[model samples]
Target: MLKPWFALCALFLTLGAIAEPSPRQMALFNNNCVQCHLRPGVGAPLVGKAQDWQTRKAQGEDALLRHVVEGLKGMPPLGYCSACSEADFRALIRFMAGMPAGTGQ
Candidate 1:
């Protein structure tokens, strides 16, 4: 279970697919996304779990950002980070989805 997830994380890290948040982005994530993304079965995709984001990422950055801005299913608008701007949301989405730094703004 957890082993497979750990393996995937390692693989992504090796391939530079995992994105790291800046200190500012970290603040936003800590205040908002961590509450759900770091937990299991909370509806939001868990960070570092590539499979969780496979489809969403394939939808490309615009669609992902739209879902965040407009809210999708159990997710609230701006992912509850009302103080966040489009750039902030972009960074946060990349961080959680493990998208590479060069992609998606």
Candidate 2:
């Protein structure tokens, strides 16, 4: 009966909920990193600038996590992602690390 429809809707909703980061993490990035790392391209743009992050990643994920959590030159602690959890930062790094440095601004 309608059970299939309900189940389908529930599945979609659950998937959607798990697909993205929390609003707090979003907000933090928006307020902080969004400036330097523009959405499509403008500022430094972290999404696809693999080169930009490659040097950092070379140090290893732990090093990158420490930099993000502790802060670095030109970047404040959490990179302004104040509310981001350690796990959130890790995921964010992994996502950014995958980007190719040559990605257009």
The model with the greatest TM-score is 1
Model 2, 1-101: lDDT tens digits are: 45433543553364443234445655565566656654344434354455676676688777878977787776678887766777677655655565222
RMSD of 2: 11.5
Q: If scored against the real structure, what TM-score would every candidate get?
A: 0.80, 0.58
Candidate 2: misplaced stretches above 4 Å? 1-28, 39-45, 99-105
- Could you tell me how far off, in angstroms, the CA of residue 92 lies in candidate 1 after the best superposition? 1.2
Clash number for each model: 0, 3
CA error at residue 100 for candidate 1, angstroms: 1.1
lDDT of 2 at 89: 73
Candidate 1 residue-wise lDDT, 63-98, digit = tens: 999999999999988888988988888877887787
Which window of ten consecutive residues has the lowest lDDT sum in model 1?
A: 3-12
Worst 10 residues of 2 by lDDT: 96-105
